[model samples]
Target: MTKRRALLSVSDKTGIVEFAKKLVSLDFEIISTGGTQKTLTDNQIETVGIESVTDFPEMLDGRVKTLHPKIHGGLLGKRSNEEHVETMKKHAILPIDLVCVNLYPFKETIQKRDVTEEEAIENIDIGGPSMLRSASKNCESVTVIIDPIDYETVISELSETGNTTLVTRKKLAAKAFRHTASYDALIADYLTNQVEEGEQESLTLTFDLKQSLRYGENSHQKASFYASSIPTAFSIASAKQLHGKELSYNNIKDADACLRMMSEFKSPTAVAVKHMNPCGIGNGKDIYTAFMNAYESDPVSIFGGIIALNREVDAKTAEKLANIFLEIIIAPSFSEEALEILTKKKNIRLLALEMREQKDISEKEYVSVLGGLLVQEMDTLVEDETTWKIVTKRQPTQTELEALVFANKCVKHVKSNAIVIANNERTLGIGAGQMNRVGSTKIALEQAKEQLDTAVLASDAFFPMADSVELIGQSGVKAIIQPGGSIKDQESIEMADKYGITMIFTDVRHFKH
Candidate 1:
């Protein structure tokens, strides 16, 4: 009887020798190439060099090693077909019963800080994916393995039954295809980032399953978190949870919002988020003062909200945070005393993040629609104050200009039609997600009823009519900042001048849906 054959070529050689030894004990002949062959022979296990089977030398720096017909014919031949049998016998192609292959480290190579285009292209494996796909397509006749974690399972079945079971073959084949698809996806993403411009003709997205959530937006829906192949320092996917219960779907959304909001500030800052919108935001000299100002910004809305701080959490800050019933607290790090106190709340999530990974230039944002996906660049273009056009007769006071900048940053992250009223670097009231601009203006003005004096208002977009500006002026806000592109800009300017309020046009709009 002819000995069953197994081909092995892998980048990760975790247990290749042990797996090959087990196959040899089952009367299977091992076939390998390059480093894999060297490793097996060094372990005193026998292996048939791939050149002996292909009858061709590896050329083009090992790029042309496995493209020969003899290697593929053996892996692709239909064992049950008489025509296939005749062809194999005519070509002297021995049937291959198993194939194990893993692609080169393209993902890892591109992740390096100094990786160049040439280095990235060199790591793209051409022959590996082809073998895995061909073997997976004929899973009934051949078993395919891409991960070393499955070595023992395949070895166990072969040791007992002399062959992998049909079910195991089918399962491993599916996993192998997924492995190759993700590898190809990562390579495509790297190439696009390097040279491709604008939207591509096709969009390919691939992510690893990071977690399985208990529920989606609602308890009845199922959901899971898929992390991007490339890791970022500020991403919620990369955050390390020091203590907490499992994060829910809403918790992740709120935490992500808090992080984005916190990224807008340079000083020690605190951002509070609720229902995927900013409820309060504040900047201060230290973390403790920042938390206090954020809590005071909207004390009622901060309950059960997610809070993210740019600075480290100290004992003083943690003590103030402990008084609030928050769902999550995110920072660069936590003090020993701070962690000890916060850990007492068993259900709150405490996360530590590397705050310096702000690679804004290459960042992309993705949103899933009904049947398709929408992709765009992240809204990270730094707002330029040099482009501001003061349209009103009165110039803004120095204090009001600083307040307007702070209010503009907070308003940019709010859902439209959004309005933010702030003073002294702390948000007094935030109106978000209203259908009409004036309606949102009313909500913010009412919330800041007593704090309106010397407060500045920021609008995400130009007001369609003068009514919103009229209301903002009536609320005693001293300055207003907005993107000025609407047809009715003159009417709002007239209203601001009539109210003796300063209006500035940023010439850039931030519309968050």
Candidate 2:
């Protein structure tokens, strides 16, 4: 006639008092340890101390508490097996009907601005995961809860049926294992980071679900968004949504591309992105002019594109942005008037982020393949201007030099076979992801049209043949910037010299695939 026992120990003690009180009302005894015991007792809820059941003092700085056989036996003993019941009775062990446990704040501790190694190591929970796993392993009889979000469901079922249903227990057990697995993966990743680079033999990836997208690239494909465990303040994942409808998968993609392109300039810059390609990028003394320059670069493409500005958005820029049917607008902050005007459009999304360059941290990029992943360092390196060589006999003028560097930076973000034409520090035409270099050049040349007389061209890679340079010569491009590594480089250099075009070789290739 003894009541069933429930073990409750949690680092995140959210709603524990009410849960324990509900269990007590349903004829259950609450056994707790450490801070959890203090919290429940402080709330005037009677509880059984953990040592009373284990008969062993929590030694080694409270690390050796729940790893005892008494706790595990209570959780893992089979109720339907006669031999298991006899062994449990012989050992004087009680059956634990439920377990509610959550691990320590290891992720939160590591994310602190100045957290030390010892601080993070000390927060790794040992006994908590053991108890959760033991109970989850025998989930037919023992129910386990790892998240506070599931507490109400467990309580509701227990209140109605006097115990959790088999289906409910199975789901909670599966979740408990996943919780522990993710926690362990985070620890593994942290330890791997502590080691020297290239010493890690295994990859441990951990991410938390940020949201479930309405759809993926297409409406039929399901998708979700996940944020990395390590914080990135400047990234789109860290952005805070302030207004409008939910972000789709395509919106997140375009916004990420826009932010990455925006990081290339230190001035008040604006970037317009569509389909993961920068259609327009502009820099100026102020954000409004920067946005105007970007919009004017390609008005048709910027109509429903993602816009990212490095500086805070003002009412004037917001007014112009509101006039366009933009999918999203991201910035450091928005003026009160700007928000009032922009928020009137119910379908446009606004995201605010810290526009940090993040140069100090060596960030990484991951791409998924069919059965594995590809990891590489992010392409944030700033090529040395001193290393550039002027191969063309006609040296570029100072004005052409400034515009060439701007175009060089802009071209690196474009896809392969990319060509970016710019004048006065703003893109006039961009041709990306074409099949051949000549095709991209033709497309960019056609877009540049009248502006080709003064525009400078930047290609993501060197021309394998002189055909692209011959094509550029046919247009009136003044100067060219490319990562000249092809064996036919001299042919292109001769072609540029014949056309009186200034060509510079950067040596560093920026191929984005």
Candidate 3:
């Protein structure tokens, strides 16, 4: 058999010298370009420049080096086919048995502060992706390596078998394709942001596989996590799971819900999530007390729920959490003792995330339907109190006002057509995922029982009809907070006036689904 030919071009040169030396000892010819060739030659390893093999000089400042027909003819040629072999011979092209390439650091370039548009555009690689795709498409004959961490494994397999296995080549080819696709996505996203203002074009999104779950929402379905290359605040995709059994689909869903809720508060707060809904939420003097209050709000609901805290986990809080049979715990930080204690429970997932400012209130929203996705701007900001106009004779008391605010915050996180009734900063009843406004109001009041008479009501959106307002008055709710954007707003206001109920128009909507 003829000696195998290997092409090497990489931005990260870690362990390349030793790798190339071993390849040379094995009688594989090394072909590289630019900085990669310089590094290998300086290390006393004989190397041939890619320009020399292609018989074409690097042009456009090295961007046109590997795009030549000679490089691609070698990578794409099929060894088993006589036609392909004859074509390569007629073109004076040598077969490339292996390809090792990594793209330019577009992510690093875009992350730099005050980076110009020119700088970002320059980092987009042309030749690198073309070479990677060419090699990956011919995985039946060529082995492609993209990640540097796999260098040792590839070398070991090659040494033991005298050639890279087909299975290994296929796996590496898949990785290379994913790498190039993600790179293209980053470039598209960056350029899209530079377009004219008020551009309504959809954002091009791409994500890499993070992990596969044991199952989806149920044991019968399958699920997997895909993380974006673009970072976001309170991202579960970036979370480091310190300990646990493999995270299930439900665990990840609830953890994500808890993280989003906890990110909304500036003061120390804790939220308990179960089945992608907030079971309990509270703020206190410190993290420990806050967690205790949140747990007490609905202990039965929190039995196996996920907990997220905005503050660091201390030993005291950790001790209390350790006593519960919880599924997951997430916080910005955890004390050394706390982590040590928590890790003892092998089945609980503990995640530590770097704290960041809450995502922009105007970020895009997405919902998955049976066939496609529904996209809109996230309805995040609650109505400012200054804009609220009381349309009734009765005014809410200071305590009732505070309770209304708390209830509004809770309702914002609930599913659309939602109502939350609260008293003394505790959620007395939450009616969520309902079809109509009146149905939600009835469910909330019925759940609150006797406390419904004294509690304040918060609606996620405006009452389309006066029946919702009348329903609240019949329950003896003292104050009502709503966005007040319905066409029949006058009818609702008149109904509130007749019932002596204090109603405020916020001019902001909080629809969640």
C-alpha TM-score for every candidate: 0.97, 0.97, 0.88
Instruction: Put the candidates in lDDT order, highest first.
Output: 2, 1, 3
Where in model 3 is the C-alpha error above 4 Å?
Answer: 78-91, 149-171, 196-203, 336-346, 359-363, 450-454, 487-491
Per-residue lDDT over 1-513 for candidate 3, one digit per residue giving the tens place of the 0 to 100 score: 767899999999988899899888888999998899999999998999987998878888777889987899999999999999999999898899999999899988998879999999889999899999999999999989888888888889889988889999999999999899889988987887788445445555777778988889888998998776666656787778888887787888788777767656767788888877777787778999789878866778889999998889999999999999999999888999999999999899898886555653345656789988877766556456787877777899988888777777788888888888886546767777889989989988886767766688899899999999998887788799898888999999899988888987777787776
**Could you report the Cα RMSD, in angstroms, for every candidate shown?**
1.6, 1.4, 3.1
How many clashes (backbone atoms < 3 Å, residues ≥3 apart in a chain or on different chains) does model 2 have? 0
lDDT of 2 by residue, 280-349 (tens): 9998999999999998889898988999999999999999999999999999999999999999999899
Please estimate how well model 1 matches the true structure, expressed as its whole-model Cα lDDT. Answer: 0.90
Report the candidate with higher TM-score, 1 versus 2.
Answer: 2
lDDT of 2: 0.91
Pairs in clash, predicted candidate 1: none
lDDT of model 1 at position 426: 95
Candidate 1: residue 295 lDDT (0-100) = 89
